[model samples]
Target chain A: MSMSPYSFRLAAQSLHREKWINLLSVLTIASGLLVISVALLVAYNVNAATGKLPEKFALTVYLNDNLGREKIDALIGALKKKQSVAQVRFIPKDEAMKELKTMLKNANYVFEGLDENPLPDSLEIRLKREAVSPEEVKKLTGDIGRMQGVAEIDYGEKFLAALHSVKSGVRTVGLSIITIIVAGIIFVCYSTVKILFYRRTEEIETFKLLGATRAFIRAPFIIEGGVIGMAGGLISLMSVYVLYYVVLTRMSSVVPLLSNILFPLDLFLLLPLSGLLLGVAGAVIAVGRLRY
Target chain B: MIQFSNVTKDYENQTALRDISFVIEKGEMAFITGPSGSGKTTLLKLIYSAEKPDRGNISVAGWDLDQLKASSIPYLRRNIGVVFQDFRLLGNRNVFDNVAMALRIRGMGEREIRTKVFETLKSVNLRHKSDSYPKGLSGGEQQRVVIARAMVADPTVLLADEPTGNLDPDTAESVMRTFKDINARGTTMLIATHNRELYRNTGRKVIRLEGGTLVGVGPG
Candidate 1:
């Protein structure tokens, strides 16, 4: 009819006799969760950093020395009228030569040999953040090329392609790894509870004889499984935090932008929350798979 | 009340019980006697709903065995008590908690649970052993704990298979006395055993079974 005294004792007895087995199972689940969470953290930070580059990087469009000042003004005016062009700075010939020399400081001697400034006047274009995709930048550059006396446009092509790949791949792989890890955690919990159930077959059979409902027999084992998972996850999460801090301290030179990307505080807050959620999910799966 | 109508049970590769039919009335004490593997335990297991009959119908406490819903099997068991030959006592819990289990499942409050558990343990003369774990007790004491648990729920129908089979003859007699007293209080009891001397002298109904078939129903 309902959960009675007999079933509770049986469930406790079942969990108690097989403590080590349950502990091992929970640890297995926690390790999988830790892998997934750490992967997510890295992916999130990389995506954020990569996402900032395109909108801020500029493209300089060169004009021929023969172009009239009035035509250059008209072309620059047309680009500024478009909502996508956030900034339009005209670089004069003398100033462009100076900027070129400063950028190539390592090879300043080569530029010093020239009698006159070989650089053309240019317009430095900065697009609105959302309008700076590689394809959109190409389209904007093509429009500028059709203008009178426009010589060339310069933005690094290989860098743009690499940035785009990093941005897209993070999202795709983040989801895939997290899914696989969570599924593995659930499987671990299910098998743990299933083994415990198998070990206590006689006890469960006795509960049935004493009139125990399915829920009555299931509640305590579920409680025990959830407790194991939560404890294991929390311990693993702590270990992961310590690892993150140690790594950040030891290897910050390898990635100068890592600190600017994701705060350690954010991971500290997320780890326990993720652990608790994983605990609940693992317990639910264990309960669902057990025969009533 | 329990009734078996042409019930047959088949395992994966063997017939455990074949074409068995019988009716046991309310408030009657009967013994199921047979040699080893003579379907004695199989019949008790059916009464406990461990498995459904492969063929025919068994009605117990107003439930049709074949028609019993998976969710409602516990309801039939609520009115019946089963004491296993192995005792099946939980080794992790002390005696008090073990006996209180029957009441706890029904959501009985702690104060009431303590009172009922104490009362049940007193009946088994195990009130002094209430704090002891099953592994710490003698075989007879552990079996008595099992008996206390079964009767703690106040089941109207009691099915004990080989309840005293594992105990010494002296201990076995005391167990029989416990059942006899329980039956005297108007509860129906069925005890399955192969001990001829134990049941032959008692003034109770005896259903003799051999080779999975009933040979005689005699009065002790």
Candidate 2:
């Protein structure tokens, strides 16, 4: 027997009959989804900010003042050959002095007494983003400092470590919040569906007596839960988008970096789809154990 | 066809049926007449598989009740229509929907359900009230709606429990005539009633019960 049409009609009728309670359930689900979505947005932006810090990270390898040009070139070639190294640029001592002078143009008086440039010729080594961890940089620097012509190696180890910690902490807290909120939404749906089932006990009894099968009896309730969840998801999607638009646009002028925060439009679309699946799951659990 | 042999049923506090046995052949229309708590309803329930027998055997339309699984009870009920004294109708639904429910449960298409529901409502003289809700109908009208719902599926056996207990004399007579018309069309019927007037000149079999025991089984 094809029960789809009949069940759909029955479900539609039920939703109309119990609009008030169903509306409340949808709003409750939407609220939970909104909280999770906002947390996701904050975590996404934080991760993005922390992720960009590695692009500018580089190690300065100062060479011996008496090293020959060929030896410096050989050291640059060797550093470039390393698996973690992305690029190596040799800055001549004279060019470094000129760059330093431009940077301190307003304080030129501090450099007037120097007889000769104190800075040594250095190779700036940019590493792969994936190799920017404090431990990896420390190992690489230790290896490079032992080279014959290498004088010193410097990379900000403490800052890199702190950035990694912040990124991981954001991820852990974001996932935990989302999990609890998703479970809360499912419980809201479960309780609503169960209450609706009990309220319609008389009608269900009549259906049972009229030879309706278990599937026939459960179809409408299941559909109701799905519809409620989907609606809640749609509402939350709109709410989160509005929040993103208002807050981000207004705050972008005050904090220009806020404009770099990704909206993740593709992933946000899963809100309603996930809501629908979770709603169906909640309804299934609610009705599965009932005496039908 | 319906047959019961030495069927016994007990509730938590009291025995509802004890060592009861009877048979109503195909196309037969019979009555079970007894006082309150005489196990008349329990007998009907047993035939419909609403309650299992404590001991003994029951076969209806060639299906053995003892061997029937719980999942198959709905199929058994599809072939047996039942009416209650309280007129168990969905008040939120109109008479058309109420009658259509039985056909819908059978997964019949909407077009066929509409045709069958209208035909059954016409049979019970309720076609004009097809759009009216149960709450708007009188007691007798509500009972006829229930009868239409029960009959729309064209079941082989029909059971009624005090179908006219809540009706006035004229309405009650009219409802009985409808039942007679259904039975005349070759459907077996077993009606449970305490009112002897419902069976007094009908010339049909009447089984009597007293305190869950079969007191007599003979023609009314």
Candidate 3:
């Protein structure tokens, strides 16, 4: 029924006529979207901050005391050839002892009575990014432990497990918060549009009398709901930008790690698109509930 | 054209129509007259598919109501026009928009809608009040706007339930004159009213119902 312009015009008029109700709906949608966006921001930063932990984990490969220089060179070459190894460095017994003395500081006196250096030569291995997960790290450590002239491989299982736990926890909490906020947004849009529908019952009755199809009767209300959602989404997105620039960036100065976090530009489109769909969904459901 | 075959309509409390059968040929005008609760309105509602008959068949403008799907009701309505007792004008809209509603529902273009609505308003002698809302118009003017809306789409059938019940004698006469002119243009018109003066000397067929049952039919 050439409903595009007519529906849009009607929706705009209705929105203006019922400014207070529409304003309340927009605010409700904005508040819900704001909470979701803030949670997204926090999740983004957490992912950025914790994203580096896996790369920092090193596998300390201790060599046998009787291993020869040639055998050690061959072992280092093999470790370097592996896809999971990012870098490797050999630590001779003397160099290891020196490092221990530096770490011990004045406690080096405890080693003074030893006839010779008891520390074994080791390879400080840094795994590639792909090996950051606990399972991958374990596999890499096990492979190295079976290598010739390697006495043991330690990749700090407890530390890797703790990192995995934290990442998953943040993700689970972020998803849960977003789910709740989305539900609330839909409910708000549904009830608001339903109330708006009731307010215009007379118009609807007249439309029916004029032989208007159901789609024709429904289009304007759906458009109104969508406008509400889009406005709310855009407003919330702007607020998020303001919070990031005014609050987050300033906080980053005090907390250096926050500097690396980014608000992906894609969300500007995504949030409004999501809002439009959610708004349309609520309107459809609400209109379908009407008897006529 | 309209036809009712053994039509029986029931409400929660009582029967609204009882085994009634009638037919009005195409391009004819008829009036339904009876007391307040005599099923005049219910008969009109049945013709428009606003309510389904409990045990009967109604066919209007060549579409059978007994087998009509709910989804097809709008299209069926598109072929007919209905005017309500209370004017049924949208208070929020101006007279021009009110008249244009039927054409708009048909998805007619704006330029054409504007032209047709203006032409119809002119026919109703309310062209000057195009921009005035229903609340600003007189009862007769509002009723004229409703008539304009009904006739704007040029439907073959028009049904009016007491189109002039709230109007003064002069205004009501004017409305009847408009209906006569419309009926002369080959559109079938069925009007339900209790105003004896309207049908007294009109020489139109009158169908009378008493307590949901047809009591008589003859020229008034």
Candidate 4:
């Protein structure tokens, strides 16, 4: 049977009558969805930022202090011949010192009394896309370490591996937690609808006697559950937007990196859609459990 | 039209109807008079498929309940009206909604449902009480509202169980008069009641039962 206007009216009446229960359900769903949204936002930004880092990955090849310019040219030529080696740039001793001072900034006073520029000339070897992964980078570094004029090789391998591990861990844990919260939202909707159904047993029985199909009796409860979920979804969207705004405005001032991350505008639609699905699923479960 | 061929029903600890056999012609009015636990309510329940028989078969308005599918039960029920002793009307809904429920479930147009519900309410003398809730109406008025709800869809058969069990003689008679008026319009009726005065001198077919067994069947 088709759903009538009375079905919506019935849902509205029930929602109004049980305001406290509906409110509690909405709050629970909203809080859960908020957590999900925040997690998704963080995960997406971290992945996006890290995904860009591999393209900038570089291997620093330090040359021997006493080596002649010709030896350095030979090493650069060797690096350029390697597979997946995109480009090589030479950083002279003075330029390295200049970059170091820039990195140290106010701490450059420690190097003021040094008799000479202790930094060695280095080759900055950039990798192609295929060599950007940890394994390929490690192999390249090992090959460069055995070369003649290369006194040392530093690719920040440990740091990149740690970042990769952290990203993987966050993705795995975040997905598990989001799944659990979605289930919780569904349970909240189910329990609320079940409670409402029991409270309206008399009305349900009357509907049956009046020749209402099983679908007719179930449609209103489902609609009511969906309404509750949508309310929760709406509240969650608002909470997340407000949270993002606060983070953007206040927190970014103290931690400038926070300014780089943003909540996707499409989440405004996706989060509510998720909540609606959860609510409908909960209603289906609650109504399916009835004897009718 | 209704038929029960050697139908028997049982609960967990006792039988509700035993080897009951009967047939009601189309447009006829009959009374099921019996003592408490004598299967009067159980028999009426069979007519509407509320309770199925453990043995034998039943047919109501040409739907063979013995082979009735669960999916088809609603359609079968749409053609058979039922009135409970407790006057099962939705307390949260106004009388108009309560009576219009039958049409609403079937997705009838609002305009048609409104006119039909109003007319049905008038027939039960509850037109003025259309906006009143069930709690605001008296016992008899609530029962009349239930009757209006049952009759609003113009069901082919009406089965009522102890419809006046909680009413005084005057109110009970008034409720019966509404049933009689609906029945006069060619709707078959089967009423279950304990009050012997209800069936006496009525010149209607009476099926008497004692201890879940049919004891007598004759004109009252």
Candidate 5:
């Protein structure tokens, strides 16, 4: 028949009479969203924490003690010309020795065997915030490798590899969590709809005999499912925000490390979107699983 | 008007209707009287396109059943009123909205729907019970609401499959009278019933069926 207010009215009445069905469905959807949102938050934080690491350390390039001070001076000048290099500091043998002595002042016996300071003369290269590209960093090191006094060029490949390892590890965990939570949401929604059908079997048969179309029979349940999902998503966002606040307060110092990396608390915006997706996805799959 | 030409229906293993053919003309009231399993209910179902015939062509009000499209089914159902044996009243709705459903499907406005639903309920003697839900209403009242719903749209044909099966004799007679009055007003009626006495007393057209085959047709 024509789309009319009557269908909506009937749907409202049906939902009212079967309040438990809708309530259970909504709770199921909300739970699914909570799992999904929390998983996303954890993944975001992990990535954010890993990205903050490289900014703290300067790359130390050891000078060839043979070609010594003059070439080390030229190497520092060449590094300053690169747009990627933010600043450079040359640590001479004397300065390196002095810093080492101060670092071991508490443990005098640790430095007792040293005739002279064995520390190398080196250039500490600080990268611009925008200049931290692994590929570009490697190329810059190769250029510095040819410098006369440069005995060895070092940007800590081990450190870069370790940082990358954390990034991939966090991503895998995030993806796995997302996949499992989505599947769980669908399973929960499917059962909720099934319960709804179970609760209203008599009413459904009546509609069928009255010549109600399949769409007519289906629309109200679908609408109910959608509403449930949306509410669930909205609720999950609030809970997630509360959790985020508690977490940030507990580990507030880590906040500065999250600068341009993860979705700032603004990433909280993505939580609702994820909620909607989970809600809608769960309802469709749940609805499709049922048969009359 | 309705025509069935060599119509048959089968489930997975059992046949529900045989190669049955029949025609009921416009403005006629006919009873498909038969024992249980004689395909009486299945016959009415086919008229409403609730279930399609496996083989053969059936047409209702000039619409071909064989080639009916999905969109056209609702259009077909809208023009033919159906009163189920079990009443089929939506238990969640009040009597007013229940009877108003048929008219509401025609996209009638709220004001007009209220007026028309009240008028239809008055005709069914159910106006006083308008606010009561189906579960609160008596069996006869529920059937009456269903009848009111069926007649509210003033459809081309009315199909009732044992509309009185669930009611007592007195209530059944009253409901039949309502059906007769509606039929008199030029709405074709096809009622399937096992109770031969109901039709005999009402002096309506009666057709007999046995094992999915029409046995005899009696004069109205």
Candidate 6:
């Protein structure tokens, strides 16, 4: 059905006539959207933080102090042959001791009185980015610890597991919240349009007698729902931006790390578009179910 | 043209119209006059497909009412106009928009709608009240606005139920003149009223019903 300008005019007139009711609907939808947006923001930041951790991830393989140079070289070769291994750097006992001494330069007297270097020779192993999951790291460490010259493997097992856990948890909870909020927004539009339809029962009956089609009678309501949804989306978007700005510019001084939160400005533009689609869907359902 | 062959309609506990038959030829203006509860309104509703007959067939403008699908009812209605006893004007809208509703339903543009609505209102002698709301209009003026709305789209047939029920003698005569003018323009008309004065000596066909049966058919 073609949308006539008269439908738009009727919708505008209805919106003006029921301004208070429309405002209430918009505010309810906006509050729901704002909650969902904030939940999404938290999920995004947590995912980003967890995603970057893998780039600097490393597995330190401590070696036996008496291992020969050839054995160390062989171990390095074996590790490099593994598909998961990206790089391997061998540090001899003397170099390790020298690094420790440099790290303790502020208290040089403590090391100057030591009789011998007790540091172990180790191989710093970096893995492919895709293989940096907690399970993969655990399996790789297990295999290395079983190798001939390997003494122990230090991959911070607890920390890596906690990071992955946090990421997954945020995603699951965020999705659930978003789903509930979206349903709420749709319900708001549906109820509002239904009330408006009932309020105009006389007009609808008059239109029917005037030879108006179902589409013609329903067009104004659909337009009203879409306008309400889009307006709600716009209001929520503005609220989110204001909150982001306040956190970044004002509250960051108290909690400095809040400044590092990344805002996906481009992606957030979908809020109003989503709201419009949902609003139209709600109106369609409300009108479709009613007896004319 | 409208034809009813052996038509019968029944409510839950009462028969409204039963085994009734009549025909109003194309471009003919006729009247159905009966007392209250004599099924005059039900007969007008049947022609417009608002109420279906329990038996027999009805043909209006060549459309078989018995076979008309629900989806096609609106298209059928688009070619017919009904003026109600209650006026049925939108209280919130002014006189112009109320008349413009019929044309707007057909997706006419504003420029054309404005011209047609003004002309129709002028025909009803209410063009001066175009900006007035229905609450501000007298019963006669409101009735004229309803007539303007029904005539705005230029349908093939017009039906009126108690068209001048609430008006005084002068207003009722003026409204009758308006219906005659519209009928003069070659639109078929069927008016249902209990008052015999409307069709007493108009020299038009009159179908009379009493107690759910066709008691008589003659000329006014």
TM-score of each: 0.81, 0.92, 0.94, 0.86, 0.80, 0.94
Query: Which parts of model 6 are misplaced by more than 4 Å?
Result: A64-78, A81-83, A106-118, A143-149
Top DockQ model: 6
Q: For model 3, state the Cα shift of residue A29 in Å.
A: 1.3
- Residues A1-292 of candidate 5: C-alpha lDDT, one tens digit per residue: 2334555666576667777866776676677677777777767777667667767647788886666566667778888998888889988888987887789898889878788767778888888766665776788888878766777767777777777777777778778877887777666656666677677888776655445666666666655555666666777777767766666566556775433333356545665565556555665666566776
Lowest lDDT sum, 10 consecutive residues, model 6 chain A, at A262-271
Query: Across residues A1-292, which tens digit of lDDT does each residue of candidate 2 receive?
Result: 2347899899899889989999999999999888888888888789777878888999999999989999998998899899999999999999999999899999999898899999999999999999998788988988998898999888888888898888889889999998998888888888988999998999998888888888898888888889999899999999999888877799889998777777877546788998898898888888887886
> Model 4, A74-97: lDDT tens per residue?
888888999989999999999999
| Candidate 6 backbone collisions, by pair | none
lDDT of 2 by residue, B2-98 (tens): 9989989999879999998999999999999899999998898898887899999999988999999988888999999999767789989999999
Predicted complex 5: DockQ: 0.38
Alpha-carbon RMSD of each model: 4.2, 2.5, 2.3, 4.1, 4.7, 2.2
Better of 2 and 6 by lDDT: 6
Q: Sorted on TM-score, highest at the top, how do the candidates line up?
A: 6, 3, 2, 4, 1, 5
The total number of steric clashes, by the backbone 3 Å criterion, in model 3 comes to: 0
Error of 5 at A242 (Å): 3.7
Whole-structure CA lDDT of model 6: 0.91
Question: Backbone collision count in every prediction?
Answer: 11, 0, 0, 0, 1, 0
lDDT string, candidate 3, A249-292, tens digits: 68888987666668878779977988888888788888888888
lDDT, candidate 6, B1-220, per-residue tens = 9999999999998999999999999899999988898999999889889899999999999899989998788889988988988888999999999999899898998899999999999999999999999999999999999999999999999999999899999999999999999999999999998888999988999999998899998998
Q: Report lDDT per candidate.
A: 0.79, 0.90, 0.88, 0.89, 0.76, 0.91
TM-score of chain B of each: 0.96, 0.98, 0.98, 0.97, 0.96, 0.98
TM-score, structure 2 vs. true: 0.92
Worst 10 residues of 4 chain A by lDDT: A1-10
Question: Where is model 3 more than 4 Å wrong at Cα?
Answer: A1-3, A73-83, A95-115, A248-261
